[model samples]
Target: MAGVRDPGALTSGQRTVMAATITASALLFSSLTSISVALPVIQRDLGISSSALHWVIVAALLPLCALAVVSGRLGDVLGRRRVFLAGILCFGAGSVVCAIAPDEVLLVAGRGIQGVGVALAVPLALANLTSALPGHRRGWAIGVLSAVTTGVSVVVPPSVAILVHFASWRWLFVAFVPVTVYVFLAGSRHIAESPRAPGASMDVRGCLFIAGGLTLLVFAFERSSDWGFTNRQTLAPLAAGLLLLVAFARAERRATDPLLDLRPLVRSGVSVPLTALAFAQCAVIVVTVYVTLYLQQVLDLGTIETGLLMLPTSVGSVLLGPVVGRLTDRGAGHHLVLGGMTLLTVALLWLAVGVDHRHGALLVPALFLLGLAVPLVYPSAGALSLGALPASARGVAASLQIEARQIGATMGLALMSALFTAVEWDERNARLADPAEHFTADEENKLDTVLTEAEKGQALLARLPPAERRKVHDAADAAFSTALNTTLIAAAGLLFLGVLLALGVFHVPRRGRRRPGP
Candidate 1:
């Protein structure tokens, strides 16, 4: 394996590669937040339904989830630099399409195209960065990159808020094009092509199976809340996706040149990090979505304020990133990762049981801890997962981790939504059944019809008398808060499980050893 000539500093070329890849990541991640911030404007400008507006986000995620493994494997079979550049072209073209789009349909189509580019670029970018240096130093690079991107994710919202306030939402799509072009140009000149498998044939059937499976699964979960779990639309796709994934596994086992070689996943070091990362992704989507919902729906905070309030988590990530990286390089990654998971669990429990309007501002500390937890877990888990594999397998290894996180994110959304609805419904029903509540038949009927969690609060309150509204609103808020807290508790449990899994499965090097650690 090739090593960086200087252990202390990156060469000019390595720095260029790092900058281009990290910049590309910033571009991709920032788009999600920018679009989120601009969604209201987009809906008003396009005059689209609430349902249709969601497709703008879903379209991007689907292709990104589906194509990741294939893109990573293609990098190994073809060339990483070549594929990475092509991704830039696709992303830029898609941005142009979105910038010029006149309607929701075209915008969603453009987003899907951009998702394809993301699938190609993101995993390969990591593969390139880690491959640029020797194994021992990869942790620091991953840590810095994670911190930078996390910061970007937080920072983009405030800037996007300003941008959307002053300019048309279309500018959001156009704003990044120049940066994209620069990264493309810089990468073409500076990024070296990774080692490719000579004359290796693409596993066409395996690619089709996994892509089709993941796309279907993601679509099913993304739509499950809206369509209802028992609805035929949801069930049909969910069952089909599972079947296809099973077929994909079978196909991979038989293929001579598989798109995703599954053998590495059986190793304890690799599997533990991958699983832990998946759990972390689940925690992220769950906490972020529910917290945003809490801020907006319960407290009625505006988008900008809610975003700003979420900054402590981002701050913690930035503060701890470099330290986590240094610790990993020193063979302390095992302790850091498990400790991070434990912290995450504690933070989630803190929010779950204690969060309230009176003490809501105190959430800052817990959120800050949440921030600390991610930098500790993510970069370290990524380093461990990739480091466990051979150089030849690193591309696929990175892709596998990406795929797991994507699936985890989708599943997290589904799980939280499902659990919230169930808990909220039971809470509402138990109230309706109580004589102490003294609910009229009309109110009972109205409450009984409330299916979605959002409807339980404002929708019901809007129909009640001013005198009656406050009581119903309070009850609704309590239910919503209860549901939210329950979901957080569930997330906390998962993080605890992640900690246990890492401890049980992963065997770390002893302290005072000079050996490299995964």
Candidate 2:
């Protein structure tokens, strides 16, 4: 059993080291989600179209997904500490590039560099925590890591939005540079270096296959709107991606030391948990992206106000995470997952029925429940999946888990954005066909700014005759309601699919321990 110790249990030196390391990890995770709040600002300043903006987000995610497995393999073949330090340096340099970027293309390139660094740093950080701590204490440390990384999504984004309101958006990247430097400096002294395994060669072929396949897949999703789902542009990439993935699976089977060992997925216990994890991640991203748009675009809230309205999600996750972690440690993961998914399903259904411009309050409880479900599901899924693998394969298992998450997030964003854009276009056309009885060209232009300034909208309306103003208001409200309802209904279907996958694929049998030997 682990003995009780001070919350600052490490020697002064070790405590500083741990603090620096964990802080850097938290910042990386936070920056990924926090940027959502600044999307409008980015679009305005950069003079980019919506499609181009979507590519900026996808650029960061694509490299993260493509390189995640390769980074883990390199860590195992090289040294975890050395690769981790390299990742930190690359990440800091990328931040500098992002801060000074002159155009959208350069910014996307900088973000791609940052993604490479993130792919390396994140998994190694988790693996390092496991190595530094022992037994049950390891579980607690992992819980703390999860809480920091996940909780930052709620805390950091809003704080950054406040900065955007007061200062320039470039300051967001500038703020991260100092922290990254501190982590690199402190990590040099405290973290023990893992020795490279002898005779382990990098799987170049396997890396190419997986990276090529995933790139094609994500590109297909990103361009599906413009290309049309059935057009040659879309079908060609989708088909090529599927073929390359098939080739990757075959190559992995024959490689002496594969980049991604497929053998683990063949095991019932490991496969089950991984499947559940993928679906859960997909559900979370779908809801988050749409809700953020709904709040800002449809309801006409400011960045800070939208972030504040999202507080219920952050609060629920922080409060319930530890209790769920304890339950998972006690071997109650299956039931916990079941309950969590059920709650998520209910929340999505509620949003489907109740979300609207006038009924903003109705969304709070549903968002809270959805947030509570995430922490409960995520850590438990991770623990169960890792538990099914041998101790030697822990690093690869961790990499695969993170890869699944990135893939889910990429797919969710791509799909939901397509849906929302389609709905928006349809509503825009409908309104144009029969301009609101009182709407003038001036009011129509003002409606575009409603996302940025609701007060301006009210002033514009006040200048019109009372009956005409009412007509304009009614039209805006109807459009918002129609778009929001369409998105929510889609979310409900996705969540229900997640629940079904969880029940069928992740249901562990009563008396059997997870199969060992990947």
lDDT of each: 0.73, 0.71
lDDT of 2 by residue, 1-518 (tens): 36866664556665565576678778876666567667666655664444445566666777777777877668778888888888888888878888998878888887777777887887677766666654546667766777777667678868876878788778888988998888898888777888888887898888788888888887787677556689899999999998998999999999887878787777655665666676667667666655765676666677788777766766766788778779988988877776776777788777766665457788888888888877777778788778778889776677778777887777666776666555654564366544444466435544533343345566666767765655555565566566667866776677677667667765546556545675
Candidate 1 lDDT, 1-518, residue by residue in tens? 37636566777888888888988987786674346656655655665433244467657766666678777668878899889888888888889999999887899899988888887887688878887766767888887787788778778867765676677778888987898898899998988788788885678887778778876866676566456779999899989988999998888888877777788888777888888888888887667656755665566565577667766766766688778888888867778889889999988887776555425676777888888888888878888777777777777777778777876776565656667766665665565443315555444434522222334334555655567655555565676678878889999988888888888755543433233333
- Show the colliding residue pairs in model 2: none
Supply every candidate's count of residue pairs whose N, Cα or C atoms clash at under 3 angstroms: 0, 0
Q: What's model 2's lDDT at 201? A: 81
Angstrom error at residue 431, model 2: 3.1
By TM-score, who's the top model here?
Answer: 2
- Give the local distance difference test score of model 1: 0.73
Provide TM-scores for the models.
0.76, 0.84
> Which 10 successive residues of model 1 have the least lDDT summed?
448-457
* Per-model root-mean-square deviation over C-alphas: 6.5, 5.3
